[model samples]
Target chain A: MTQRSIQMDEKIISRVDLLNICQDVIEKGNTLLTPGVADYSVVKDVSNLNLDASALPSKISYKSYVFPRTEPVLYYKRSKNDVQLIDVNIDSKKIVILGAKPCDANSLNIMKHLFNWDYSDEFFNMRAKNFIVIGLMCSHFDEYCFCTSVGSSPVSEKGSDIFLIPLDENNYAMKIITDKGKEFITPYSGYLKSGDENRSKRITENVKQPDVAFDSSEVYKWLGENFESPKWEGVGNLCLSCAQCAFVCPVCHCFDITDEDYSYTEGRRMKNWDGCQFGNFTLHASGHNPRDIQSKRYRQRVNHKFRYYVNKFGEILCTGCGRCSRGCPVSVDIKEIVSNCKNDQKELR
Target chain B: MKELIKHARELLENGEVAAVIGYRQVSAKRTKPVIITDPEETSALVFNEYCLNNLAVYLTKARIKLLCKKNDKVLKLAITAKPCDVHSIVALIQENQIDRDTIHIISFNCHGVAKDFGFDFNGDNLASKCITCETHKPLYYDALFGEVKETPQASDTALARIKEIESMPHNERFEFFKSEFDKCIKCYACRAVCPLCYCQRCITDKTIPCWIETSSHQRGNFAWNVIRAFHLSGRCTGCGECDRACPADIPLSLINRKMSMEAKNLFSFVSGRSLETPTLVGSYNEKDNNELFM
Candidate 1:
């Protein structure tokens, strides 16, 4: 693993220039992109913005850029003699999610295993394999932000092909972790700067976030013994079952597939995001809903993250991105939820 | 819930009820439904808020089994329900999906059952749904257990998160959601879990009509999710199940809440109260404005 640091002149090849650079790379048969739309990342002002590309700016969804909210999973057509299958294009373009946060980028591994495990889903894999992810460290915290608590720091490299650390004026300390990123950086060797290991290490300490801690080791045993705990019903009753927390969570992975019909014979199966917050998540098609009560549905969300995911993946499903807390409509904080799950309540039971 | 199980066992043994329909603990604290015709299996019964699954569906399935299937004796069954589960039962009854007289309902003093967050034990922390329940009472019953109490208030949206996002400039909030939406892998957890989303056929899946396009494109994804949310306006129960079920982690409640708030302010109706009442869009009134629909 030869790690090389680079000094990228902030303005030599501007983000817009990179768009052209991407276009040139594609012209040379290497699919790459400075993915943005006029409506999506076009910032009207950049006085305080430091990231290269702004994420999508509407409730529309970025999953479509990769997984797409809906697409023809496969298609069928009636012919004179026999039915013909029309396969939707599953190949994906290579693009750089240039300014992804560590939480979002690291989630790709979870996503990868999900689509790759039972059935190798070409749809998600196509986009995943092609995209070269570049993560930028967070410098400040927002009110709903809580990434550090879930074992991820702003500068965390748990998931990313390339990570960029903003250093002193006009420089970025870059670390390439994957061959995909390495290949992309080869042509940009001119942008390389000698290693400044001190500055690079300091980047992790530079982030600002309100520290919220919990003993990660205690989470599993507490849940194992407290299935009958009354605390769950109390907090779960407040839940609206809207599915927002999972929607924003970087690691929450659950989905369903369906078919779309264009005509008598033309139809496409599609995949879309599913959440356990809805009432019938566990409902048997026979109609029995295992998690019928709202409280039961709410409990599944927390247990899935802290208990179930750890049992299976040896890692928490959550990255402490705080996106769920920040995005929740009722203000349910994961930090508080995790705290309640601790064994401190043995006396209360 | 445990005492009732004992009674159910006796009834099953003596042929008082042809079958005792109830739940058995799957693990130390988890449970699964069962129909016991034998008295010896009665020892498996247990109760608590974790007995959260709705048994209404079983009521009908049991009846159907009685008619076309195995049993020769007249069937009577026992089951438990929470308020919301009762609501579904009432809806099913109203729709003539099930008969009430043939079944016995042993509703519990629902201490709001915790939700099933799909996680394994990490050592200590459990899911949040188990911690924040509202109602603790079961409103319907042929028999009761523990103690009846009132349910509390609940809403899925994280108020602090909403406030924080709301405080940001409109564009910033939009950007935040846009980013989240962009992350969506379109796994469809939201639709699959929604109780109100029951339709033999959903419009979004009709390619002939193309109610929605099938592209992962930003605009298309936004339209697909928003349209699905809007369709549930005044109909969504705010269970937070869809969010918990999502694999790609798209925050669907933001869409659900916007509709819920809009429905509350505009229509003055709440969903899942008594399924007898049609949801907002199911019926029509002269006092309604067609402007919003347009």
Candidate 2:
């Protein structure tokens, strides 16, 4: 495999031209997903797409567009003597995501290493390969946000194919970062004009970032040193074992496979989203569970994100988007827990 | 607030309780649940309109319950709860989930709470459950705190919406709920937050038979939501936690509220109101109406 060089091409397009391009993309039979008030949805009417630079990240990331919550791997049929297997067809339609937050844009890149490590997953690869990420510069953050702590920032263009910075009300400065972005934008060259890089750079520099909450390496070190610390018990007691954090996360990729019977002789094998927070996630057929208690389960969640995944894939699993804390029923903040990981035992007590 | 901290401290310092489950201020307008076993940490305890979580849910968690055992001796676990939250505690006792003697309730005269973390406790922002609340003071408490204060007024739109849904034809009602349940991602945050959903093994998690499909697709989501509502029928205390916790903004409590009304109309029973009365789903009566069955 060869690494592609980052492109330095810059272009500017008015808001209307961007919408026109989006409409064209839709007309070409490609799926166009955009950030809505709540979550990302498919855009049928391009006028409904409002790319507010300061809007908070959508409640759920667009990772599902690549890795669906539930998808069939293969179908099976039974007969009197022999069994037959039916293959599933992966949807190969190109998906163009517009106005994605940088925090969300980097998720699939972090997850790509895992899916390709032990075994190459064609189901994931097919969708991911067909994606064109158009990331937007984020100028907004809240108490729950900590993107800077995890090696991502509001304006960092780590995983975007084409990055956009809003210059004013009607115009955007776009930077084509990859060959795929250039290839996708070439046909729309009639709508794009030469842009002033300095103006966009100033705007990018002005975007406020959430302060670093904790160093990832320090937290990783603390986790490795204190496997049985009482701090786990404290947070474990507070966590309700809901797994909302994992579900809303941009990069928490754990899944389960099950076979569902539609009839007596036919069924499908489904790959669905699963979380480590559930008590039964680690249960065995012998009725023994290694992570039996909520504390141990929670410990796995933290360790996996900061330490274990980093050790295995050389990438931290969390993008620090804060969806978990914002939607937590019991208000268990992952930012707070990881920040406190390096503190002395007395402060936690 | 001072009285609450003082009482919690005294309880912990005197070794009367093993832990105090309460709320701690996280921001100007938000409070998060905090479990403190140390006497000095009780100062962090607070009670205000911003404290939205029903702490009774923590009482049923096995990890939280383990905090009550120290040095081979079992001690009471103390809790700070709102008056509405006490209803959940009462329901848990009625279901025999926890013994009344093993817990200490530190309840307050709540004047309603905000709809969410970053909202003001005003007419427009008042939580739906607080609009029709009749319990300003806890019915059962080991220690009481806070002076009574009047709650802000809000429209009962939730019940009105339920009535509107009921008036719809069966097909339209099904479509409305089908669309709502379609947005479900199957995170089960609703189940985790409900105090009454304290099963060691949930029905969905049982894979040997796989009664409910764990997928988030249309059929799977429908089975899971309907089954969850059926299981929680006549038992939910209307905390509104599930609605708030839902990332997809599903009006989950509306179905539970509608079922609670059914329980009220059919049997003239309200859950968690009286300790002596048995739970409607748990207990059987010979005079029970079998009209639906027939």
Candidate 3:
């Protein structure tokens, strides 16, 4: 595989012009998604777009736009002697995600390796191909955020097509990073004005990032060596075995397929999101569950993110958006858990 | 707070309890649940207004329950609970989900709790469950602590909103809930947080018959939420854990509160109040009202 070189073409757009560009995108009948107070929603009115650089990441990531929570793979119609199969019509609509946090922007790129690993999933590939991520520089940090430890930062533009740096309240300096971004911005070139790259670089440099909580490689090493540690039991006792963490995660992409019957003779095979925390996620037909205990399941969750996925794909499975810890019912902080993986005390801080 | 640590440490050191489930301060205004088995770790336990989680929920977890067994002998598990959380423990005992003799409760005269972790303990930040709370002191406890402070008063906006939803026309009300349920991602955090939802295999997860679709589409979400509320109709203790656990902010307790009202009005029964009285749904009487059946 060939590596794409970084393109450093810089441009500037006023806030008003950016909104106008968004409005134009909506006028073209393309889907426009922007961060709302809690989640990303369709942006029919550009005025409601929340581009606050200091706001925390949305409760749910925009992964569903590319990999829907539930979608049909194929439809089957059964007859007396034979069956007829109907292929699903994949939606190829161009989706423009504006104001995505840097942590969220890189999720699709991380997930792309998994979806295209053994067999190419056309469903995920089609939608991922049509995505245009407009990442905005983030200036927010909470106790739960650990993006810096996982090789990303508030100002990192690892996966965005067009990255935006807020120069001021009224202006933004945009850096086109990919050919797709350049192509997308060419028709709206009237809104673009050349800007100084040094100014934007200085602003990006000054953006405060969350302190690295733990070394990812140390966590990876600890996870490999301490698979049977009692720390798993402590976390498992508190973890209620819910999939909220996986569902709201930016890069946790495990799915299950089931067939649903719409009628006596016709039905569709659907693929839905699944999580490692669920007790039944690893249940077998023989009435035996290998990961029956929550401790083992919880161990799988941590090892998969920090160890196994890294070993297999050379990429960590988490973006450290902190949505899991922020929204946890039991207040189980993954950042705290991963940081204490090597500690003997394993105290809850 | 010092007294709480002393009591918990004594329980653990003397082998009176296998573990103590309590809250520990994580930040200035946030506390997270901590399960301590060692006597030395008891000092981490703290009780404050930020202890919003209902620790009773842990009593029903299979993994947590295993902590009660040591050297083939069953030991009691201690829990530090708010006054309202005791109701859930009462409900669990009444339903025969847990043995009363195998557990110990350390409760406080809670004034109220903050609405969430970071919020200040003020009128505006008072939890919805605390607004209508009638019990500031635990009805039952092995050991009690804390001075009985006056609970702050907050306007019952949740009840007012429930009334508003009730006043809507049939179609409008259905549409209102349909939209709210549509936001559900089927994460089941609500179920995971509720102490009463202790079923080994949830109805939604029963794929043999596929009673409820697992997909989070409109019809599936509607079936799951409505069924969940119906199952908890007479049994729910109104802890509002489900509401807080929902990531989509769907206001799920509205339906549970409405069902609780029906349970009170129809049967003159409030769940989890006493162990002497049999459960409303678990027991039946010949003279029970038949109007709903008609």
How does residue B149 of candidate 3 score in lDDT? 92
Question: Can you write out model 2's per-residue Cα lDDT over B1-294, one digit (the tens) per residue?
Answer: 899999999999999999999999999999999999899989999999999998899888877778899999999999998988899999999998999999999999888999999887799999999999999999999999989999998899999999999999999999999999988899999999888899988999988799999999999999999999999888988888899888888999899999899999988888888899999998899998777684
**Residues A233-286 of candidate 3: C-alpha lDDT, one tens digit per residue:** 888788999999999998989999999999999999999999899999999989
Assign candidate 3 its CAPRI class.
high
Better of 1 and 3 by lDDT: 3
DockQ values of all predictions: 0.06, 0.83, 0.83
Between 1 and 3, whose TM-score is larger?
3
Please give the TM-score that candidate 3 achieves against the real structure.
0.98
Pick by TM-score: which candidate is best?
Answer: 3
At residue B160, what lDDT does model 2 achieve?
A: 97
User: Which one wins on lDDT?
Assistant: 3
**lDDT, model 2:** 0.90
Ranking by TM-score: 3, 2, 1
Report the C-alpha lDDT of model 1 over A228-343, residue by residue, as the tens digit. 67667545534445566665555565766656566776766767566788654566767687887666777777778878878876777776666565444334566767766865
What are the runs in model 1 whose C-alpha is more than 4 Å off?
Answer: A1-64, A79-82, A209-212, A346-349, B1-294
Model 2 residue B227 distance off true place after TM-score fit, in angstroms? 0.9
Provide the TM-score for each candidate, comma-separated.
0.54, 0.97, 0.98
Q: TM-score of chain B, candidate 2? A: 0.99
Instruction: Using DockQ as the measure, name the better of candidate 1 and candidate 2.
Output: 2
lDDT (C-alpha) at residue A64 in model 2: 90
RMSD of each: 12.8, 1.6, 1.5
- The order of the candidates by DockQ, greatest first, is 3, 2, 1
For candidate 3, what is the DockQ?
Answer: 0.83
